[model samples]
Target chain A: MRDRKESTPSRMAAVWVRCGPAALVLCAALVPLAAPSISSYIFYLMFWITMASAFNIIFGLTGYLPFGYVAFYGVGAYVTAVMWSRLGVPIPLSILSGGVLGVALSLLFAPTLRIRGIYFAIVNFSCAMALRILVANLPEAWTGGSLGISLSAIYNPNASFYTMMALMVLTIWTVGRVSGSRLGIALRCIREDPEAAQVLGVDVVRSRLKAWILAALFPSLAGGVEAWYTAIIDPDSSFNLLITTKTIVYAMFGGLGTVMGPVIGAVSLYALDDLIWGKFPMLNLLILGLLIVLLVLFLPRGIVGTVTRRHASLRAVIR
Target chain B: MRGNSVILEVKDISKHFGGLTAVNRLSFEVQEGTVFGIIGPNGSGKTTSLNCINGLFRPDEGRIFFRGREIQGLPPHQVAKIGIGRTFQVPKIFKRISVMENLLAPVLSSPRTDQELKAKAREHLHSVGMLEMEDRLGEELSGGQQKLLELVRILMFDPQILLLDEPFAGVHPTLKTLFYKKIHELRKQGKTFILVSHDLTSVYALCQQIIVLDQGEKIAQGRPEEIKRNERVIEAYLGR
Candidate 1:
């Protein structure tokens, strides 16, 4: 009797778990055939999903919330710009180089890993602000200075949209793999207690660095694609800290560590922002702020977190 | 016992926090396959010495030799990799995870498949009588159960030497007896242990050799009976 009761719900959950990813992929593939405006909105939505998942790798799994996450995105844009305009590199190769550069810049910030909690966030924020200022002041002969870079010559919205879709799939897949793998468990252990994790023979520094580098790579690629798609890149816009804030908010809204949390958070919030911003541009920020405050007060664990907390059996299926 | 090979050697190690000398020129050696005890009054640098040995803090002076390798300044994780495992003064279980996941964390570093790892974790949990609570979160366990889970978690790595800091503190009498029995069984299997505790009765019963520390200095070292009878040890504890 007990076996039958347990088996019935678990069997239903298993089917849901297996179908979730397939449904997401199918929805993403059909977006291009929807109305042209909706298709573009999805491109933006996909970009958010990619960035939020990347942020989760470090912040959710490792407990290192980097406020300077947008620095990698900015660096990716600038690197792509420099490679394409100054060095005459092709668009795709330039974007790849941008990702490599992001990894390199993250290595430079490796020392900040020793700092914990709020101080790490502060240092990372400073690093991004400093990068923005530095790029804005560089000689115009190279970085275009405050004037930014124009890549209209190679601008192709279709190519950039498809590239973003591919990147989003890869990011989600990586998060899913990490959440289920041993390394993911080790990472969560580190998040819970670094000292205990170390005693358990986890190379704390190396494990964190691996997650940080991977986190940096995705946003930089997204940045490169956005730069080419928009055909305009400015220091202020490329290194905008608002992007980092939005990514953090989305990840937190959905849930931090679970594979499905960021996706649910990004998609729902993106849709909300679109609806509010288009109708009432002046009140959009105000409404979003109020909603976030309400969410934090009522559902601090976000949607998936709240649901899983109430129904423990749903955890495996949700993830 | 005197002629046995030393598995761990602490030679004149010292650690200080600003002006406070936590451990001062402490020296000791533990023979292989023995349960060694370190006992002292509150703030006698007992925990500091354990931290220094496990690379939680580098000593201000002196050296630590683990099986003839100098590991004085190595990082805690590297020290763990070289076959030393430790439990904290306060149990440090991963509260967000299941008891089984806490045990599996260390074993993941090994090359075992998932099935083997789960089987080994269950075996350890069964030995500690915690097999039934494997699915429960670490935070949900009682203090004694958390300590038991932590002890079992370290065993997953199979370290040659174990450093247990205050393992019997606040534990129920039944759990204490179970711990004593388990320690004896591990010693029989040729495992070395360094136990730091204030429970004099348990230390006297469980340790083959003992060291007494007072105000960051070692005042005596011998069998448990000798430590109990030493004049300086008595003075250190009684404050005479």
Candidate 2:
């Protein structure tokens, strides 16, 4: 049966969003065409997109913007690093451990999930800064402090890149499925009005917490994968705010609640990242800042949502 | 589902915001198959008491029982699962979500299976004649349409009891008959209602029983005819 959750989506311009086995095959096929070193960057991009999608799960679905997603990202990286570097744990276990660690840390601040609008955002943002400062202050032995930690095989460019791509695609597929599910509707209700959602029998705090914990999974997973991909780990590199910032920006630029918005946004942003930073280093930040401002004002629906909405009305006329 | 009897009881529920008493020691019972009306001047703790029963606020004193079970401090959703549903004064709808999505939410989130729930939601929407607006967003609907949407969305779960804060405050003047017609139709379906409204005419028409509150106290209680002619209720409404 046609999904009645949303009416038959008007053509939506039929843009491509890669997911599931096809994504894995696509990445696998493209691996040979790109340079050996390009895989590392691909890994980075995949990890980034996945985290952005997860961020969309919470921020896009619930309207609660967490400016401190970086805290979870960094904590996951550190946890993985500790597991692998100090104890010689398997890559799989270490990454999984990172996810668990992320869940743990998420509970520490999951209370913020209850607050709405700017206050919620501020709490998350402050917590992230606090986490960053705490990580920076730690000594080298425990966490490599500012210098970070590195492992040889895990950091191999080709292998790590492939794994990251696999994870990124997995994260997207999972979130997409969830968006189409009933829990997604619950999140949207909480997003619109917590009190109303509560009255409607939506467990507001529980739903919010579930979204928050889910959002943390990808960042932690990405961190574990990143440590292996890059062969080096440090507080600065592992817990970069760029991971959080770019994901939020990407989700916003795509369409906060729509499934395809974040995926498309991440790809376009990476494209922008390459053209601007590669061409001129100093103008990079300026261009990034300007692009964000322009997008918010002119394309609040983000690229995918705007494009899809435009096509919907046009197709309606055509039909 | 609660049996056909006194399905809910509120005992001396009181909430004071610092020094300002919003709701005070109010007691009432809602029959399982009857429409219960709560009417009062503004700030008479009408909404506050409803809020307490629905678990929006923990009253500083008193208790609420649903189906002979305590529910005053239970989570709103838990209360809802126990067959309690509520609609706000201003229709609180997810503006970004489609009309079908708005209905889909309470259904999917509940333990109800998709088919039974979807059919029920569509049926409820059809009852209110809002099935066409199912594809539209909540914000895009007119005030009347929004109220209809809110009512139908609540009906999706087939709640045994309804707490409507105000189902017809800002509706178009012409739509009054239509609104009351649907309320009566739902009542025939055997759902109990705890309706809060200042529209005494509608209350008198719909309610078999009435409770009047003024300045956070239960000033009068009886059948609509008795309440209408009661000395204190007349004084509260006319201030004479």
Candidate 3:
């Protein structure tokens, strides 16, 4: 998962880079048959993979750190829950509608792209908070208000788990393709220097909007799938800031710009959280905060980035 | 293809940042296939005037016409798309990406295939003696090399007009010669240029028409010999 670690031979690392994605998909797909008890853990892992990778499109590629990223996720969850439970839409259609509505929500938030850096992040965070309050105040008959909507009757852990796994694969695949494409290059240019990119004839605004929409899409689907799996969608859990925090940490821990960085980051960090932090719930946040500080101080580029920087040969293989 | 037609017209443009006027009622016109030089001291609005032409800053007052089209208030990318390109004082290359990627970034919207674009990039890099360094990251290049890379990247798009801001501020002498020759070659191909620099030698050698700015106002505009004899231009550069 860490690209054959530091000492592995280049030949072996190249092979791993080629076959790793397929191997991950196969293992995740067959996890339920191998161990039924750990399905919930695997499901959560896939959820984070999707969330973090989707987030990297905008944050890593276009240099837009969206603190309110969970807005799309929360809206997707509520949209899926409401559509399925009240509107009587099919499950798949309901989840797809969640994604569509997320894109629509992104269009509405497009004006925020005019600003950059911490100002953009603060404005985006406020937008998400406003949305949470809006949902909380909605009529209970429609939104279920603070009580939240429940579709516990149709809950199928296996179905939602597989759906999330598929989504995780799709997200990683999308990021891989984008990281190598012209659009990716344009976004990276914008990230490096937006004004320079504009002068160089890169449509900074249009490129950013594209990345923003892409970053919005997958998290919405992930949220919808998570809501289905838990058989409940609540405002507090759905729009939690922890979701954004964990996604950012996972992506940063692995490496932001690369395709597999977020995947590896999410998997390793989520496993660590479950193993260590799950037991000491009170100390979980303290440890996570300390880890972030250490990461920034020591390995600002994250695990894969630092490794690649030291060994440039691994760039072609690892990427 | 060289003609006396006015290609770019800056009419009474003024840009203000809070209480400070960066460029005030500065009017100039550039002819086709000619190098127009703007010389000034540290804060004389040379860069701001370029910014206004390329749409980085919308002048508080006035109009800019490019090829008979008003483009004063348009966005920078829109200005670039309309065949105007620019370089910054400090090189603004995409430091994280490869040199090849930096070249490709500007022309991503081109209809050419990736292979075709790569070959073209290689050709341009080879012309500038940067072909061997295509695989290197932009940040690995020296300051002079970064400026060279930026200029080459701008040339890759083949813009109609180039607004170069201090293109030779930190360049090596040999690379400066190469850049000077490249500008001559570009002008021979009928490309227009607006050169902003404090290097009066380069300005005198390269420009067909030169304007001297002082504190956001154009104090002198004429041939290089006339500007050399202008007392106000001498005083602006050397102090009264």
Candidate 4:
């Protein structure tokens, strides 16, 4: 029984498994050089990919739905913008500082984890809103008040595009590792039944905090990268409610808990969003709203989750 | 460790939930390697007592000594780390995860390599005839299988004392026999168990000593035969 393998895939399936992701990432990396016109579009895709996947760590694995996820991204953007524009800190170091602060904020919000489900979501959203309000009222010299800051002095889309792509890859790799590791298992256990996990010797609170910090790190960096790409940072845009909604929608549309769910969800949904925005700008929000309603009504588990659940054979393959 | 033989000592532990006193000044002792039974009617503080002992709920008052170390208000995982494990009345297996992962969740911090842990998990599953279902999601298992899996999962951590809440409730007769045999086997191996259930037959059959609770208080404590004959227990619980 101990020697039993999970399953033996066909030789072709094994080859495809090994080459598929590498090929996809290589193509993704080549986007800026191959088609510079669509590079910004691709940058946004990677940003959402990184955002959705990072969100999956806490929301998908640990059963937290952080409705105010933009708080980290907003803070990251401000931190990077302030440091680079005002203090003359290097670009890379500013982004790193943003990520560090995002983690610090996650620690500060750790107490909210004790409150579960919708209550957590509500508190998290309120926290993000409060932060946005606070940022908007800061001294004009420091945070540029409501006027915002412009890093237009160091504007470089191509460089930031690649950074966002790299961040996407790193986020995917980290989430993938976590999804298959013991920590992931413990997280799912907590998600399913925290008290039971507790009596089983899994440190539920500590485990959740680890996922929270991991979830915070990438979004903050993505925020900084996006700030660099846009060459601007304002409280309203940086802490947009749409950021949280879009990431949550994308991750849920794919599947919450699986590795490939968010990746596939983000790519498909972002493309769909772009297509609609181009063809039917007025109906864009309406269509996306209708699609989400359909997703919740029919495929509540998201694509990967529903498919794998219905067809057990695809569990190993899809994930 | 009253004579270095008592494995668990509950000293006047009480628990309250707002206006309700779920467990009031409950006290009992279990000797090492013995099967101790806690039986009571519904809402009689049976489960609450076990929860307090396992650190799921901190007692409002009194200290619990496990092998002579006072541990009343510690978190459940810390209590588990100190070698006490528990199961829920409704087998709280990780429904989303595979049986193998459920088994592995508790012992992720073990010094053993992943291979060793997997091998041992498989061994435990095999012991309970669940080795074939290791890859199945816990929710996919039947209730009886889930209960067995929960038992095996807790056993994987090798706790010195196990608090089983309603282990025999809703179990099939064959599975109950299996549980009975497993309890006997574990007792032989020097593991102490506090079995909480209103399933008096199995409790009487397995327990070396029994304690009866009624309305958050201990109404009786004795050997199974003595508990069976106790007039107060009959009036509070056993009577028709």
Model 3 stretches with alpha carbons more than 4 Å out: A1-11
> Ranking under lDDT, best-scoring first?
3, 4, 1, 2
Ranking by DockQ: 4, 2, 3, 1
CA shift at A178, candidate 2, in angstroms? 0.8
Report the Cα RMSD per candidate.
2.9, 3.2, 2.9, 2.1
**Model 1 vs truth, CA RMSD:** 2.9
TM-score to true structure, per model: 0.94, 0.92, 0.96, 0.96
Rate residue B120 of model 1 by lDDT.
89
| Index of the highest-DockQ prediction | 4
**With candidate 3 superimposed using the best TM-score fit, by how many Å does residue A225's alpha carbon deviate from the native?**
0.4
Give the CA lDDT, 0 to 100, for residue A139 in model 4. 93
List fnat, each candidate: 0.66, 0.79, 0.82, 0.95
- Give the alpha carbon lDDT tens digit for every residue of B69-126 in model 3: 9999999988998999999899999998779899998789999988788888889898
| lDDT of residue A140 for candidate 3 | 95
- Score residue A208 of candidate 2 by CA lDDT: 83
Q: Write out the backbone clash pairs for model 3.
A: none
Report the lDDT tens digits of candidate 2 across residue range A71-183.
77788778877888888998778888988988888889887776778998898889888888888888778787677776775656666667777777788777877776778
* Candidate 4 error regions (>4 Å): A1-14, B1-4, B238-240
Lowest lDDT 10-residue stretch of candidate 2 chain A: A12-21
Off by over 4 Å in 2: A1-28, A152-154, A308-319, B1-4, B109-112
Worst 10 residues of 4 chain B by lDDT: B1-10
lDDT for each residue of candidate 1 in B1-240, tens digit (9 for 90 to 100): 234699999999999999999999999999999999999999999999988988889999999999999999999888988889999889999987668778888877787788788888889999999888876678889999999998888888888899999999999999999999999988888889999998999999999999999989999999998998899999999999
Q: Residue pairs in steric clash, candidate 4?
A: none
